[model samples]
Target: MANVYLKEAIRTMETSSGTAANYEYASTSCQGWRNTQEDVHLILPNFDSDTSLFAVFDGHNGIEVAAYVAKYLPEYIRQNRKYKRGRVSEGLKEAFCLLDGQLLLVDAVNELRAIRRQAHPELPEYKPGITSGCTAVVCLLKKDTFYCASIGDTRCVLCRNGKAFPLSIDNKPDDANECARIMKAGGEVVHGRINKLINVSRAFGDHMFKMVPNMSTIEQMIIPLPDVIIEPYIESTDSFMVLMCDGIWNSMDNSEVIDFVGSRIQKKMPLAKITEEVIKNVLPKEMPPSGIKGKDNMTICVIKFKGKRGGVGSTNMSAMPRTTVRGNNGPNKHH
Candidate 1:
């Protein structure tokens, strides 16, 4: 039975600045044999001064958690006191933890249910036992620096000088640290799943996995804490960054994606077009033994940086107007 809530969708957003660093980004979500489209994204060009934020959220069980993060993570980070004080790393960590905490609140859960009901009235009502969650990978470009934060399987990778450099690590249940933590918290890892249910050991809003008697938040079977990476962005050497869900990674490795995108960029293809091609490459042509073809919602975000240098100057200039294009929920192309 095909999931009625699942559909193929594409969204593109782009911005170019004559003064600061310019960026081009696009995202595509294909049901691709899945029952639901649980992937969501965020693209905020020149979010503040010289900073830009991009992220991919891959939801499991339900889309509410992913949608909530896509809607609020950036705002939470920007409003953080640490971010205002120029502490990007601290600010991001604080923001991720805070957002996870907020998801457990009664008001937050109610709001998510309301939004889901409004978006998909055909779906069943939200119940107390319903447990949903999402994985997040975020890239924040501030001045000449880049910050990457991730939890769960979604990943952020940088392509520099035609080579792939991972910005975030995949948090899986089989990892030694994750397994140790889960065991200590009275949770068992069975077949690479936390309690034989969730695969990723760190994510946002898996309330069931997070509920451990007398255990601290960090000691839960699955924690919302993210692994963050900070690096200097070299305009001359760095090419672009790829943020994607596990669906892409499950089919293609990091190097393969980088090479594919690099080859397309060499042909002078638009960033949005490159993203479309990537999605197509991962989408399965025929249904296989797994019952579904692709079996996952593939979402990709490509951020192509302008080769210009220099941070936002003293002149307070407004950002370029963002243009968004959405494609129909079918195998269609939109420029």
Candidate 2:
């Protein structure tokens, strides 16, 4: 079985929110019915003088990979040469791969051991290998634009004038481009899963799938490349943006989610409350639709731009489903 549930669900919610230059945000996560909480996120409202960063990570096998990424990705992005050279797009793309490369078990031994010793000196530090991985959805508010980079199905959506405009696309194994890459790497998409082991075509870590002879990093069965989407931050129409994991998307589509969050904001509900209600609204009381993955770990990040209209009141941007390539889903997940 790919999923596990606790005897009883954990209803407690972890929430965070803050304000930056022209941006304000709130994020929340729930352990739900899962045996353990594997989702993680980061909220840096004042990342720098002119920019801010927000992201969500959906851990697959465990939380180690997601937690590590949540802790290190910002520093990695900040240090990338391309980003330093003013090529933000290239910088983000390279940063994802660079970070993933550091996860190679053979090379991470010293690093992981050192980190583990410091975090939990009494706990065991030995592990066979790095088998865990996570889906990443990152959003960087740079000046007057939004840069969203993502791998796997985690997503970032912008609510502009009450409309849903997805910033990052879902990278499922069933997707054409994703499927093609998997096949070319001698991997198969079994029941929409990569080699019947994972559902996402791209992710951070998951080193088990990266093994193959004579293949470049991008040619691996599971790559770390991220799709970066750029959208201008228009104050008049763009209200707010939503960055969420599959847990949230599993139950709500772009329209329903945008409208759901918007209606709450219109009622003047707090951002943290809006996020908590979203998880509560979709949390199942019994076996989830498919028996495979029942209730999931839920996470959401909302970024607001104080504007003339303010997302349905926060993020109403311009882009249709096709134009933005929001994406497709399959069983073991949602469609």
- Give per-residue CA lDDT, model 1, range 175-221, as digits (tens): 88889988988889998988888899888888788777776666778
TM-score against native, each model: 0.84, 0.86
**lDDT of each candidate versus the true structure:** 0.75, 0.77
lDDT of 1: 0.75
State how far residue 105 of model 2 sits from its true place (Å): 5.5
Instruction: Give model 1 RMSD, 1 decimal.
Output: 9.7
Q: Which segments of candidate 1 are over 4 A away from where they belong?
A: 1-21, 119-123, 126-130, 291-293, 311-335
Cα lDDT tens digits for candidate 2, 1-335: 53367767888888988776576788889988887687989888767667788899988756667778888889989998889888787778778888888776465645654644564454454441256788898888876668888899998999977799888978889988888878988899989998888999889878778778777777777888887887777676778899888888888887888999999999999888898888888777775656534388888888777763223234444442222312221111100
lDDT of 2 at 125: 47
